[model samples]
Target: MTKKLTGVFLVLLGLFATGTAAVAAPPPSGSTDPVGNDVSWPQCGKTLPVSPAFAIVGVTGGLANNTNPCLAEQLAWAGKSSTGGTSQPRVAVYVNTANPGHSGSWWPSSNTYANVTVSNPYGTCGSGGGGAGPVDLPCSYIYGYAKAYDDATIRGVTNPGTYFWWLDVETGNSWQAGTQDATALNRATLEGMATYFKGITAGKKGPDGKPAGVGIYSTGSQWGTIAGTVPPGSPLAGLPSWLAGAKTLRGAKSNCSLPGLTSGSSVAVTQYVAAGLDYDYACR
Candidate 1:
């Protein structure tokens, strides 16, 4: 969480959906939008933002399918978040994401999860052929789904569906390297997590009268390399974006004008680092 990872976009063999310029309209002049902070296991035993306007807590211990040691205590701290921002939520959680294929200890080998069979869009998961091993789309989807499910059901996060969820996609995590196929598999993994998050929040409205929100957190270039351009029909389409890579609050605010990770999504928050802590600026 201290060092930023850089990633480059891979050239796709086939054309993928391209995102439009999704900019965030700045808050009114002199508007006192609540500035919030995000924390995880890295912040354990450290001082946190004093009464942050809102708080985003990490659910993992810096890897997919892992737990944050301070989750319960952080959630309690997050519970103290104040409501003064526009698009930001009072309490939200993020999960680390990766697509390690079969190399991962918990890589998915089947389409059925928790006894329910999933209809994968990339055909059969274990059916695809990988240069090194089996890194098919279906398996990637299952891997993402299982991780998010574990985070929600067993990661000590109480009532996960009640809070907004952000998928932390960074180059620091284990991802398939090389060609477009890797990008597709990585994208599928994220889409799977989105499906599960959206499913759990279905029919349940939040303070904004919308289903618990699910969004992506990454830099534009990192997202391009990991997921390429998400298809408009894909589950990732239209989700909000939380852009990272700003040095100051002013820089973070300016990032709100940048394009979102997807064509249909809008930038909702821009993050900046100060004193080793990640601070977020509500864009809308």
Candidate 2:
């Protein structure tokens, strides 16, 4: 499905990581921030924006375990981006994320994937017959790792480790809701996915010399509701956030000043909707 964009603009002031004071909203006529578009399965047969400054292609069919039918074509579209003056890559990818527990069609029954043994924080993830619950932190983490592995290996992405990844954590997708345990499990799943990406990008680096691995995409409210508090030592902590919810370019720019999902992270990109399509603004 296409990405969902929702949220209001706040006029509050703030500072960037470099200590530069925040800029005013409704950027000047010749702003330097690159404007790009994001597309996914829902745009399969439709006309996409021509020569976007950058492009974010979705790898899933709106679910964690499903593949986007148009991934290849959309990726090609992304590769053709002009990149303009943006710091973001011409082509980046995002994937849907969820934690449906054992209720999911595919659940991990072991703390391993591709022969790598995971040091699961919640203990060994195994069948309930062996004392481990059918659904636990280890299982959730393995499930996330498995999903990302499949997405990178079987979802048509080439040299998957070379590109940056964005985890799409939206309330529209399946998630364990309602309590602290639910939030922890959900966070475990995301951490598992991030681990896979981070491992593959071990020797790789982005334009800024940071790992070209995993980032997150979601609204603040949705992120808080789904992942709750990210522990200081968690893998998901300190990763950049791609915020959503603005309806205009000005709103997106303003949102760049909003707090990120984690304390050490900041919003590196902000999304807006116009003409029924999703547009992203890259923050410097």
Candidate 3:
């Protein structure tokens, strides 16, 4: 990856840090919190046109847009009105671990509006490398976002609609779905996170008053390969999918490319620009 793309990824993960003193907390209940990070690939910078047609918020350059600013900007775009559609934009927040969860305010006073979204934290790559176990890190781990979200932060939230995404940029370069064709340790870690999400928001509510889905972020070939092959009765079978890729989303053979393949209510948020910004869209 080019230096520019690498930097953009760093900034995107950095958005998760909330306060000065980072702390040690439980991993968000999405993945197993296994000892690794999610994977984020570099793009050629040719992103798709900004659209009001999708939901999930894909953070890009902190363009300092008034209509949107940081997390709020992403939410604003997701909730904006399309030219002629009634689709309500859905905003997503990366559970950033760079900064601590919050201090005085329940939500981090990033000076950004509590857009009801945040991303998971970790260094540029996602895993902190402290690697205590499947997923454990020091309080100061740069990309170790687990510390940012714990019992303390959520209990303090006046608005729990701000869904927390346990995003990791660390999927092995290959899919571990079908055969026992590889690292059981890594796969277990990833599965452990999926188990976590089932309970993360066991007591939370959505912006529209519904249970939110624990997100799984990965590239199509990586996540889809495993998720695609899991049997209907598998524990990880019901998880939601967040496929990362810019160009594929712009085209028709997007996440929904395969027939009869239910990504368990999936969304494809691809990097449209080299600015580390991405946006997801609908198949139909």
Candidate 4:
């Protein structure tokens, strides 16, 4: 999507529910303190106004049909831009995962949907090896591993350490609707992704020495519509939140205190647009 169209869609999404700060919480434990931007093909080749502290690049399309063409360039630029900074500019990846059964997409005959999500991002980032073999599990579990595998391969990360790994959940993307089961499925999908990232294994570990800490990049309303409330004591309940929906830097800052979607997770980041540039506000 073009930046203009994306901006307009975000505007229509209402820039998060407006209100006074409902929660005062410190940044999540083990999270790096830095501002950043998340971009896909739209921002490619455009000069950013300031060097971001980090960047999260999208790896695949909503339906896992295509890989972002500029992921390598974006990653390379992120690496170069962080030179001489207080810390190396962190680079993370996000993937668009949806239900193939209800989202109007046909499951590939040869490759399971989860395998496709993993391979598409991994292969696109110059890691051409195929994904781990398909798991005869729920689609969500498969997708989680698919995303984790792709992220590990792209960064050449070899340890199961903590790093930012966001799942892009938005209404603009394809999703299943119409019943409580849909909500259950959606939650399962997210948990599946998180499970893969946090699980320990000799080969699954990334170079960062820990698994990627999973976060949700969506607003309360969108998440409710897509997956319902994250149940208490669920695996996803304690994950950090990356709040979306802000039109300006001030708006993003104000949103820093909104109630977190995850009960105990800190609201770690807020996304906003300023002067046609997408920016992030890391909650301190």
Clashes of each: 1, 2, 47, 12
**TM-score of predicted structure 2:** 0.85
Residues 162-182, candidate 3, lDDT per residue (tens digit)?
454434332332222334533
For candidate 4, give the lDDT of residue 48: 43
Model 3, TM vs. native: 0.44
Error of 1 at 34 (Å): 2.0
Instruction: Give the per-residue lDDT of model 4 (tens digit) for 1-284.
Output: 22234323443343232221112223222234455767665555555424566666666533343455555665566544432222212656666655444233332222244344442221222113543322122544444455555654553433334445677777766566775577766676577667666553314322333334667778888888987877786668977777888876678879988988777877877887655556677775
Model 1: lowest-lDDT 10 consecutive positions: 6-15
Off by over 4 Å in 4: 1-34, 62-65, 83-89, 102-137, 147-163, 200-211
TM-score of every model? 0.85, 0.85, 0.44, 0.68
Q: Please say which candidate is ahead in TM-score: 2 or 3.
A: 2
Report the Cα lDDT for residue 88, model 4.
Answer: 18
Give candidate 3's error at residue 150 in angstroms.
4.8
Superposed on all Cα atoms, the candidates' RMSDs to the truth, in angstroms, are 9.5, 9.4, 14.2, 10.8
lDDT of 1 at 153: 93
224: Cα error in model 4, Å: 0.9
Point out the higher-scoring one by lDDT: 2 or 3.
2
For 49-122, candidate 2 gives per-residue lDDT tens digits of 66667778888777787776777777776665445567677778999999987567777778877787876766
